[model samples]
Target chain A: MPDLPIILAGVINGLLAGGIYVLVAVGLTLIYGVLHIINFAHGSLLMLAMYAVFFLFKPPVGIDPYLALPIVTGGAFIFGYLVYRWLIGRFNHGRDENILLITLGLSIVIDNAALMFFTGDIQTIDVPYAGRMVELGAAFLPVPKIISFFAALLLCGALGLYMARSDTGKAIRALAKERQGARLVGIDVDKLFAVSYGIGIACLGAAACLLMPTFYVSPTSGHAFVLIAFTTVVLGGMGSFAGAAVGGFIIGITESLGGLLLGEQLGQIGISLIFILILLLRPSGLFGGKG
Target chain B: MSRGTLALCAAGLLAAILYPLVVRGLAGAGVGVSANYLINVGMLVFFVAFIGQSWNIAGGFAGQTSFGHVVFFGTGAYCSTILHVTHGWNPWLAWPVATAAGALVGWAIGALAFRAGLKGSYFALITLAFAEVFRILANSVEFTRGGLGMLIKADQRPENFQFRDPMWIYYLALALCVVSLAIAWQLTRGRFGARLVAIRENEDAARALGIDVYTEKVKVLALSGAMCAAGGTFYAQKYLYIDPSIAFGVDKSVEMLLVSMVGGAGTVFGPLVGSLVLTAINEGTRSLASVVPALKNVQPLSLIVYGAMLILIVARLPDGLMGLFGRRKSGKRHDA
Candidate 1:
């Protein structure tokens, strides 16, 4: 067996990884809470934002990803809003399954479009701080990972504050609780939906910015995150923000420990198994209300 | 079915049966088309249609809507491949066993998921997770070669289930398609199919009406799984190779769903029509890329078109393209 310090390191690494997952799942859960449909395009949209960061950081522009965060996030918000307005909104008239298919189709389009344009090459940004490490008890973590973890937490807290305090957020919550009642009370339900979707995608944009220095972006990068985000969302309860946060951390640690114990190939099974077990047993999630 | 519809189906079948011969004849007469290539294309259409029909059975007819039907496909492929390659079992014999294995897996998943009362997106997500778990296990296990993939020896013989002639595989695929269509026809005409339809419309209502909703769902899933597994066995035998990604990938799931949805879910001829349309689009894009030269790597154009079409179909053509072929119905019944 490995030393306790090594195990502690694994746990630390998992927590850092989970930070990114929390951000991703936060967006997913928000969309689910408000729209009551799984956004299959969540990963693809994140991929697109990653591409945006890549271009902004490349030679001609040479802007830092940190600097590009606001631009990318704003652009993502508008893109998400318009996509909902033009595509997803138009198709939202039937069974919730229709939205699932629509988002899936949207993901396919986005992923393939990325493939055609981005050429499937994995792109990474070279930041001076990339190799820097911070010592935390028994673990030595990358500077980017540490920064991202804190930033992710900060973002989530900010989003929570916004949702609890903002008028638009209240409207969204009202819609989620009762769509017809929200509409009856003079809330512009459709616009609120678009805004909620925009905010969700905007979270992805921030995540992409946070992730680029530490991770690689490829056309299929979205596939890697999609399942993890789903697992996080499901584990945390489908539409609960706090649940997603805790769930992301748990999943991250599970992945790290799973890799440590089962070898990398079999270790990946942990997330999927957790997903299945949660769906089977406590599907409402750890802190979620009735599913 | 109407007399007109029956006549249309007959004409279509006759055309399909004659297609290979006609292509070969034209090629012999020095036509532009390659008989081998066209024949292979025909085989692909039917193969895709067959698998799509499997998905349609559970997802459409029974309203299960799984995002991971490829689990059964991969299970069948790996099961038969392992038995034939490692255990020295004849693939012809292993084929049925693999199919049964698929059915067992289907029943197990159905039992667990249905018992949990997991419906809609929760059910879909759980199935996807199961596929992921299977994929990871296949990647880690020593028996599956740990992602090096398993390859059957190229012993080209009829007895080994490996055909020297591509035509044999084509015929096999065509037979499978016909069988799938017959099964779908049975579903439409039988009490079980009606119960499934009732369940799909409303589970509580179906239960109130005395339908064993859970049992029927499980049964349809088993049937669907068996059919898909058989396709997997055929795929392995035809290609003589099995890999984790090729067998259990999400792409296959998307393709199956795309075909059924675009063609018309819950309709008998939906998968066939969808497969043909998609294959045409795929080939058209490939040839178009070749012609344009500058668009040489624009191969994803076809899938982009498919994705767009899926969105359009769900938005506007809920009944799918098959809906266009059939008359507008007065009620919820969409059988064509």
Candidate 2:
């Protein structure tokens, strides 16, 4: 058995990792809520954003990842909006299956394109503050993880507030809840769909900025997040923001504690098993309303 | 089936049978064609087509849309490989047991998922999760040699299922493909297939019409699993190596889905057509890459094209390339 301090450290690390997972899951759930399609390319898009941050940080155009956040986030938003407009929106015939295939196609293209241009070599950036640690009780956490955690919280808070208060946000919510009704009520449903999708991907951009300091970027980097993100979204509920937030934290702890208890290789089974159990036992999820 | 369609099928069969001989003849005559290379390519097309047909049975005909059919594939490969290598069983004897293992897995997954009333994307996601679980398990278990993988000893004899000539392997793959096509054709002609189609079009309606949707789904999955597992065993024997990644990778899942979806889901010849097109694209890109000095790592370019074609197919040609010809004979076949 591990000591109390060790357990506490695991919990702390899990919570920190949970922050990033929350950001990713929130994006996914938001897209599902609005568009009713699981964006299979979500992880690939994140990988792309990470590459963007990497380029911005390297020699000639040297910029800190934190500073590159705004640029990447805004670019991701526009890219996402156009993608929805040109590709997804054109073929989205209200069929869940078609959308899934389309996104799968998009992911295939993006992943392979990355491999072609960037190669398979892993790329990581060195930061002065990367080694800096914050000691809280028995936990020794990296400075970047701490910053990322707070930033994720602040971003989610702002997104929640925006969705609740802003006119566009309310319209997006209405559209999600009742699409035909929202359309009858004179909301530009198509444009709102694009906006919502853009916002969803913009979240990935911010997550990339946070993730790059501590993680390496590779063409196949997206494979790691795809299952993890799907698990978080499914565990949290398909289309619930609050559900996703809570789900992210639960998954993070599960991963942390699982690694602590089981060896690293076997620990991964916990996430997949949890995903299966959740789908079988409670498809609606904890905060979801009758999936 | 129409007379034209039957004649076309006959011609295609003839071409397939003659392909290896023609390649060899060309090579002997010092023609541009390479016998070994073309034979290898033919084998791959048939093998991929066979596996793709397995996906077609469930995903295309039944509209199950699995994102992790590789679970069964891996199960069969590992099952046969382990039985032969670790337990010291004959490869031929291990084949049937391995296939049965795949069918069992498929039944279990189908039973659990269908019993829970999981459908559409939920079902798809769950299958993906199941594959992940199996992958993790395969990576961790000591008996399976964890990540070190398993290797079958090379004994190029007729009884060993290993062949001295690549032509034999090609013929074996072609035989598997023909059998798979027969199975798919039977589905198109039988009441069982009709029930599956009904379920695919609308499960609630199918159930309302007194069709045993659950039973039919499970049966189709088991059948599909058996076929895919057989292909897996063949693949393992041909390569003589089995790894957790090779056996259970998501890439194989994607490949299976891609071939079926891109060629034409539901149609009997869809997988064959898809395999042909994808293999051509793959080989074409590789040759082009080798010819061009500037493009050092252009292997992914083929996949990039595949991805683009997938997107285009989904957007413009929902019925796939087979759909193009089938469009001329509308209402002749059941299409989702």
Candidate 3:
């Protein structure tokens, strides 16, 4: 028989992990769907957002980190737009290797710039409810983790609805599926690409803000979650929204369960191994359409 | 080959070989020689060059950009360290074992990733995930000594391959660099290289032409892994220490890619030149920091510089520094 408390704790952590993974993977999936590029800088952008919220919440402003989410997201959106217009747009139809290399270089620049500004010290917000826990029978769940989990679910659901019903969203999807058809239909492909990039960055920015309540903010902290996000994206099938969501939960659970069974370190290794195995077994992903 | 080119190569080799002797003579004449600093930079150059060449096997040749190469490097370092520290095996004996381990790991990853039809960004993501997994596992294992790191026995012995002189380590690293370049050059000019290029150009076409895409990719990945493992072993031996952060770090993987890209990916001499240039920049930056106190606390400025340089190179000089020299005009014919 399993220990009920341990299992419950795992479940709670899994949910939190799933939420965070979704936040990271959503941007990557969006970039892939729209531009067919991986946006290696996506993780670094998350780092930038974390710092933005961190600074905005400091001292004179005295705004709560969570409250600064809008500002962070807005900043990321603008930054993303600029990046798409100035950097990514220049390389349309370029080789995939070139895109990867360029984005990787961008990631380095963002990460190191953060490091230079913030001095590499790990800084965490001391929110009023930071360490507080809620009791669920025998299991105690952290408050911040619960908020993040629900927040992620709500945001993803909203985004899904917007994409399904909104005019701009439809145009973006149309462009993603068939560029020539979208252009024939009078959709401005360049503007659509920029908007999608902005939205992707905005998602990451919101996630960073949400993450500050639980995790410490550091220049390289994005590196910690970036790989997990990538794993989720792959597990869910590249560019599949629902897949990203489901994959996020699956990965989250795997990490939590593996941690409980093996150890925290082995948990990550186990997740990676499982991700590879899944890729081997199902190339198109569990829920993805055939390539 | 032109006389000038041959003379240049000869001159570079001679200068590298005699640099230590020149420094020693200068020191004997009471002119200060920073032999330690030079050796440190030189070792970095060798390590970066070795990693770049290894990455070029998959990324430059096969056009499969993998972001997780540090996993093999970390594996090699950890395996060699465990063998020597726990099992009392000789470092020389441990090198092949580590390389074998890397090869096996690479084969497994390639088998899974390639079979799934993951390419480009997808492949890079998978590789990055693998590295992260390795890092997490390394950090959690008590046997690895965790974040505290595993330290080798301090008393230096030639038999143990431990050295007090930086020159010994420098020469060893230079030898490794040379060997790695030789292997890369040979592979890039062979039948396998031709097959890799064909696949890179068009997988479907390559398959139509009777190429076994999966097998070839796995083979190249394994070879690359083995080479990287060998490099890692030498790195561990040279430093006399190993840590999860240093061994399995993502930065290490990025450093390799950056060096390769900067020097000119797919070219034989690209990795070596990239490593040398980057290493020089790194050393120059550190020395500059000492001269200017304000710059001392600016963490990751060097990385920022590298990143900016990479972006500039990609945007303006896609062919890199080697392209400017006109060494391999034929390489341009196979642009992705």
Candidate 2, clashing residue pairs? none
Stretches > 4 Å off in candidate 3: B1-3, B141-143
> Which 10-residue window in model 2 chain B sums to the lowest lDDT?
B327-336
Question: What tens digits encode model 1's per-residue C-alpha lDDT throughout B1-336?
Answer: 689878988998888888889999999999999998999999999999999999999988888899999999999999999999999999999999999999999999999999999988788878888988888999999999979999999999999999888888888899999999999988888888889888887889999999999899999999999999999999999999989999998898889999999998888888999999999999998998989999987998889999999998888887788879657422133321
Candidate 3 per-residue lDDT over residues A95-154, each given as its tens digit: 676777788888998888887778889988788999899988766788988898888888
- CAPRI level of candidate 3: medium
Predicted structure 2, TM vs. truth: 0.98
CA deviation > 4 Å runs, candidate 2: B326-336
lDDT per residue as tens, model 1, A170-211: 889999899999999999999999999999999999999999
- On DockQ, the stronger of 2 and 3 is 2
What are the DockQ scores of the candidates, in order? Answer: 0.64, 0.74, 0.60
Specify the poorest-scoring 10-residue window by lDDT in model 3 chain A: A91-100
Docking category of candidate 2: medium
User: Which 10-residue window in model 1 chain A sums to the lowest lDDT?
Assistant: A89-98
Q: Against the true structure, what is each candidate's TM-score?
A: 0.98, 0.98, 0.94
